[model samples]
Target chain A: MKWLAASALLFAASAVAAAGGGTRTNDDAIVGDGFAPVLSAYGFFSDAQAQRPAAGVTPYRLQTPLWSDGAEKQRFVYVPGGKQARSRGAGLLDLPVGSALIKSFRFGGRLIETRVLLHRAGGWIALPYLWNADQSEARLVLAGARVDLTTPAGAAISYAVPNKNQCKECHGAAGQVVPIGPKARNLSAEWLAAFKRAGKLDAVPAVARRVPLWEDRAAVPVADAARGYLDANCAHCHNPDGAASNSGLTLTWEETDPVKLGVGKRPVAAGRGSGDLQFDVVPGDPDHSILAYRMASLEGGISMPELGRASLDPAGQAIIRGWIAGMR
Target chain B: MKMTTALIVAASALALAGPLHAKTIDVPAGNNAQSRLQEALITAQPGDVVQLGAGRFALSDGLSLDAGGVTVRGAGMDATVLDFSAQKGAGEGLLVTASDVTLRDFAVENTHGDGIKSKGANNVIYYRIRVTWTGGPKETNGAYGIYPVSSSNVLIDGCKVSGASDAGIYVGQSVAITVRYNYVEQSVAGIEIENSRDALVTGNLVTRNTGGILVFDLPNLPVMGGGNTLIEGNMVIDNDTPNFAPKGNIVASVPRGTGIMVMANDGVTVLGNTLANHGTAQVMVVAYPKAFTDARYNPYPRNIALGYNTYVGGGDAPGFPGGAQLAKAFGGTLPPVIWDGLGGPKALLPSADVKVLNLNLPAQGAGVDQAKPALLSFTAPPMIAVPGNVGAPARLEERIVR
Candidate 1:
């Protein structure tokens, strides 16, 4: 009878292991024993390149993507056990446990890095994977990488992959690791409809605010373009509830207060980041504005967004400069 | 069941043996050095030491250590350098959030923001570290070289810092801190202890900054009620650098050429320091109500004792405006010690509220306004009580270096 009991216990333990309940080590490697693989013996995005949900993952795109040193980005959201994403009015909905956000960054069609944000029981953990030169498999990169690449505009730029802890510098809100983009204000109508059609969304809001793509120059006013760029790039840190809340600058889409929106506003703790410019934004003068000064420089301590870009964003800069020049 | 029990017993035996061994992780020097260092930090066990090889490692993102009792040592300060001139991620060059962590013998240069920042971490030590921005002082430099905020039991020794837009070495909202044997230059404020309690700052060489050293208490921060600080045995000289801090920052108001400026703090003893060649007054004591917008702060500076310091070659090219009280009092040449005399009604008494005793200087080196009235005289309302127990008085004996 004891021998029969021991056999039953061994069978149960094997069953648990097969069910993905096995122990996993927390290390720097991206591929762990029980981790979900990025590609499944097929080409990149073979299952669902840019369409509906496939293989427990849903393809998504931001209406206005954050500037990342002019790199091309593709984003995907994966929900474990086929759980759907609930809808909210303002920002991103609270995701369920075991959810993952995967973002792939490519420079000049060359895959550079893939970042994964996994929502676990503890909190959101950021994991970065650096793609090999052959573009086959990406390995986990716990420390960041510095790659010197030339931009399409023929400018030499050094691209940086953020380390895991550096991820929290922008993702942290109220001391918790949270997602920055994918707000209702930043979701295109067609994308929202696609999520609804695929049965991935619980409830779409009645009226979703839209921030027009800055590239669609004719559709968006110059001011709206500048606001959209700032909202996508700087609002993650400069918003009232964001990481730089202590600075008293809020760059959210809905911010109405001129001071909080950085209109003629002085920086609180900018130190040398002010670039000797008096105001964060100067009306009718981007030349003398601290905002433009920080955006134009790559060598100084006064860069905007303070991270994730080695080269200047000329398109974004032009829009903001035009807006500031048009202002009375 | 027998096999499972036997496996568990073996794991338990291994766990018991783990504490007996100390792990040493030697990080290889290469382009992926930042990632390897971070990986080692993440996987480091207690009492583990992570050492960096001698080379210049270019890092784009900042590194962090969240594990307690971990030591990160590098091959001497200049030998192992972490260059963040092209940093693309993270605000601080290195941020530490774990207690009982020691970082030594490395140089962090040209970070996007503060060079090394510790937030709310206790028992942290930074020894023989050099933090610098390669280019000369620019308005676009990083804010701080060494910044520790809201921490306790901190020691920063034998460090060299320069080219910070704000303070080269700044300790804010902390307790039981000791900052000594550091060389600071080319910053706005060389060394600053702000809104802290029980700090001992000594044996530091501060030069060519906007202000040599400052002790201030500002309102609306996580920590307040700064007092009982001792400043002694330091060289503060030739701090004529222009203030380039942003307008809204409080440090922007500090005039250039100040050796030491104490503002709205209490129970500070300035002793045994050498001061020289400041463009403004060597030392100035002032109130906060004139400068700050916060209503909850204590505006008055009381119980300030200035004693036993050597002063020379200042009182030339005063930076205060011509109409300012300080400019009028000293006639464009400031005395070694000048008090603003704005400490409310209690300042009217004949007693020495701001004392200067036993200083080996000229007779007219110090000036106090006996009849000057308080500026903005109504009594300040009570400060809002904050949560958490007040930190106990850190005994002076505990701070003495044996």
Candidate 2:
């Protein structure tokens, strides 16, 4: 029976078991063991505002809304190919600093949605607003989700939910450090106001919640941008226990401290007769940038971040290339 | 009464028995072939043939053979398919790590890595095997279609290979190997022989690769270039494309685009092979005897010969042999041959002068079109190529299924 369950687990990732768009029927339900219980199928607002949410709960006056106004007028952040139909939002929940949110979208009742909590280390930092967790399966985490703090009313709030594994899978390194480059994590106005009051930013009135940051792009150096991209993409599997951890290209934002990250150094076990290409970054030219060439390739030889995504966005690619071009 | 009943029953049973026939295993089209293949292999004996039905079977991992020797032949090349589309990845399609293995027909498509690999096994014959990556001919592939390594006494005959990230048919560190009558195109190297001895590569059609045929003795391998080998009867054509692999990583070790290159090797005979418009050189020999130890084997090839082969230098320019087919793409005239090895001056007999043999056979000619003279000659004191000194065509005519 355990083997049966294990074999059934392999098919779940390949084929979704949820009944949607008439894709599932009674027969398909038994195609594999429908392990989890079925929850309702609805969007964020629809599911949250329902009279009863799974267990008994009534909706009170809503502290925050899923959308600005209840219409499609709220634009999806434009990814290169399509709109943000697949993106999810995360921010300081009004519930409490340590509160957890466990929402399950109907994958045969498997608890698919996860929200992580983190206490602010530096003064309250607002992640530059962009699409961070841009997938249905993304486990969105809040930096303040686990802070052991007293509310203004003096009520002790602690993170009640269990810790998540997928957060580390997604954010890799700099896990709780809000990713503020390239894309945003859909920060909320209440969180922004709290951060400003806490003196995290130079004071600006917290009106126009979803104001676009189309301001002249800040002059962050290319090195920072390239490092940020590497942290976001490569650090996940390049660390210890990762498949390429042995190859020693640690791209974690913290580990890539330049000196530790082999940026200006030659690689080990590279350029052997086993057909290994040597030198990940060759300083200056993109043609000389082995890392950049590998990132642009699809063959198994050089393609990095071997799973999940396809090609890197052209604009993102340019920022990394700009950094490599500056390297000696 | 008992004897009479027994005789009647025996006669009836004998009458019911039918003629003996070979067992036929049928794989219906669109069936899961990974499991079916496993079952067939388990149930089959010698001389048993499994007919794979048409259409693609989304296979998981590669099929492994545990038996001593057997053959898996297909009805049509494209008809029987093993697809690794959703199976993540595996080493290769069919892995034969045992001796006396024979696999022919059918095609392995979309494998994550190598298409077919036989590692450290000998007495293997791969006939009419077609291994591709994109389900069809496609450039951005993973690596070698037919790759055999660390083995000996192997024969890969009458196979069609194309679109590998690495060489199409690569034989490395093996001896007494025969690779002939194959059509290879659009790969990094059509046929590559590295650190192997007593091998014969003849009667193959090679085109549009980074190099048609490459013989390299890589530094830091256990085997030096194998000696006393024959490279003949092959239609080696323009191999001008850069290797399809990403340039940054480890592939920088191999120099690109030489039709027939002998690097750090000896006793190599390049005879009766038609070479046309190869980038860099039609034939290049880098005989570094000191490099032999770094190449893993001592006593490297001490003799190399080139005889009786035609050279079509592609476009209208003076090439080799008094400079007849040298085109402008060859970077003016022809590249001068420099023996970057031991016996450097002595290897150029009668003169210490360098020479790059140009192949300038007319495109439309009688025997000269298919046949050509060898580019260079080498007869040192110690080593000799097979059959002593004989002129033979490198490529042989292929048998078309039509």
lDDT of 1 by residue, A1-328 (tens): 2433454454344433433522221111112222232321111233223322335466677777898888888887765555677778757865666676778888788878887777777777776777778776665555666788877666787777776666766786755678877776677767777776777777775444578876685567888877888888888877655556656578777787776676766654567667666677778999888788878877535677677877888988898889888887
Docking class of 1: acceptable
Q: How far off is residue A326 in model 1, in Å?
A: 6.4
For model 1, residues B314-386, the per-residue Cα lDDT tens digits are 8676675542454455454555665566565332221222222111211221233333322222233322212
State what share of the real interface contacts each candidate retains. Answer: 0.44, 0.10
Q: State TM-scores per candidate.
A: 0.76, 0.47
Worst 10 residues of 2 chain B by lDDT: B391-400
Cα deviation in Å at residue B162, candidate 2? Answer: 1.1
Q: Relative to the unseen true structure, what is the C-alpha lDDT of residue A229 in candidate 1, on a scale of 0 to 100?
A: 84
lDDT tens per residue, model 2, A197-259: 543323333332231221211356567656655654565555543323434457655563452
